[model samples]
Target: MELAVRAPTSATVDDVEDVLEKKKQWILETLYGLVEQDDPPLDKEYLSSEKLLYNGRRYRLRVEESSVIEPELIFDGNRFDLLVPENDAINTRRKRQAVVDWYVTEATQKLPKRADDYIQKLGIDDIEIEVTTLQRRWGEYRPGHVSLHSRLILAPRKIQDYVVAHELAHFRHEEHSDAFWNTVGTLVPDYRERREWLRVKGSTLTV
Candidate 1:
């Protein structure tokens, strides 16, 4: 990533110096245009373009230009990575299984083996971990199981740990009630701030 800096100029008008404020804006616009032209177009046809591991299961990506307004994952017998166009609401559902399957293998190698340890510390048990891609939630704890979005791999390590701890707390308390929060606090005292940070910056995780 390159940044363009513009020098300010001074011009006297009515004994007042006119600062060249617009130069900075112009330079930034020029840099953005150049970057756009130089960057390669986003390949929307390659399925399994990127891989991520949540828990232990490997997920393959499927990219397509569809009418769906938002990017989403489809699990229709097989996982499908779906990318929709904002303007071109096309119905193209091209499927690519594993163009880059190595990503899953690599990501799995990076996952922690003792993912449930943190929850166990809080006296919770009988919870399973599942890795998936969810647009809105980072982690969820259902009855006897927990689903963690594979996108969490994009988050910082501390934040990811916070998410894990949060879900684990749910095993004891199902809702976001006071009891649930107190349980989370026992594991991660600053979980609220980390949760807020993930909410605000979650979009940055996507490629």
Candidate 2:
């Protein structure tokens, strides 16, 4: 099987490589299981026939091979028209990277804004927001910063919003204590449902 590591900018190559080394067995096992089950709808293969999710909407990818200068992605609410260089069109790994790059760009632009809004509502102004790659978590929070996963861009807006609030709530309590959960509930009344949704479908959302 093929393996690719799209790590956070702050991570060094060595650090990413170390993580991959540690998780190689787990990764191989997961991939084998997914392959056996035929996988969820969108397995991030980046094939033209695969379905993609954007803000809770399902879209099928339609690749238009062209002898153009660069790859281009266009979404007209129904489908993703990915115009790729003829050479890149047939390269599955390259196509996957292109689609993931688009998702990262969108996440960088939109996720931070959503987090900022939640930060304001939480009345916390000292926290910094950054879009990064997190393989095992949707968002991670520290004393002064929060790193949101770029993969979140594919989920619905409400789910994304819930994650922001959940992270922001961390500032009030370091652990997932009752107080911290209360803070999240105050910010998002239906957070339980959102958490449930993530528990059920989060595994299928991968790069």
Candidate 3:
């Protein structure tokens, strides 16, 4: 971005600092240009000069006066750079896995007691809770196990309970028939509202 500056009359250091803060992008770009230039034979000498003036304010320009040095990117001669690129696929996968692990750990600690209570109240038997990250469903029930998506951690407590109850209902009905709806409604009368909330907010629960 270009910053247009008018002539300044007796501008102070504070005025230059203020303008620099406001035109940061322009200053950085100017600094980068100086760093990339070959004519200066860049040494340790760095300096800032007033490049322009606008509205009685001095627009200061920063010159690296030396090759750009990012300490984080420096490496021993024998070692390669370890910084992960933002767009790298493997880095993305690792970030997602880390999020899943965190959700699973938190949910396992928070949900077990609630799961046991609901199971007993519903008279369900031989059910195990397994937490995993899923793309679509919040909870699913097999013959003897309940698979809960790690995304459930993002839901409010009432909605989480509704999901657990919904799956528990599935243990008895096996399908989303009227009987299953009735069972879920018996446990959580606001099931429809909770389900709608999940549908609307599910996308925001990303890692």
Candidate 4:
């Protein structure tokens, strides 16, 4: 097997190899899983022809360079029409930033209400709902606030609910003990399946 590793420019060759050696088994398993995957991996290129999943439905992307200074995203029940400034059309970083800004705006509008419903159902008070550009986890709960990965808006509603419930459960139990799982199960009866879906497809939930 051929493995290509990219690390910080400052890192030594031994440092890179040591890290790869430590996670060799995991890397192999991930590669095997990619090979076995039936569905085409979600596009991370953020290009015009890319297919994007939003709220459980697929939307084809259409990028239009417009005179408008601010980027705008419109979904016409069929696909996403992204109107961007002409300068942003060819710049990957600017284009990605525009798309991510839209996603973050969407999550800010939708997720808090959904979280509020669960919070009310669980009788949890004084819970602050916020969106974050989280790289490692879906969501996390602190003493009085829950921070969700903003990109979760790309996932289906049920999956989003599972994440919200999972964090809320943390409000009661700080650790993932039986009591914690049971609490999560009580709120989301089919959580096991939902979690499995995230495990399989979550990596593709990128913008």
- Regions of candidate 1 where Cα sits further than 4 Å from its true position: 1-103, 106-114
Local distance difference test values of all predictions, in order: 0.55, 0.77, 0.56, 0.77
Best by TM-score: 2
Residues 42-149, candidate 1, lDDT per residue (tens digit)?
444544456533322445756666666545455443464555455664443422223223233433444333365685586656666777655456766688776776
Give one digit per residue, the lDDT tens place, for model 3 in 125-165: 87788877654467767888887776566557776787788
TM-score per candidate, chains pooled: 0.49, 0.75, 0.51, 0.74
Q: List the residue pairs that clash in candidate 4.
A: none
TM-score, candidate number 1: 0.49
Candidate 4 least-lDDT 10 residues: 28-37
Model 4 Cα lDDT, one tens digit per residue, 1-207: 346788999999899989987886576335322222245464466668877678877789998889878777777879888787876545667666777877889899998777776787788898888998765578877889899888789889999998899889888988666898899898999987887777677777767
Q: Using TM-score as the measure, what is the rank order of every candidate, best first?
A: 2, 4, 3, 1
**Candidate 2 residues 27-57, lDDT tens each?**
6335312222224554465657877788877
Off by over 4 Å in 3: 1-100
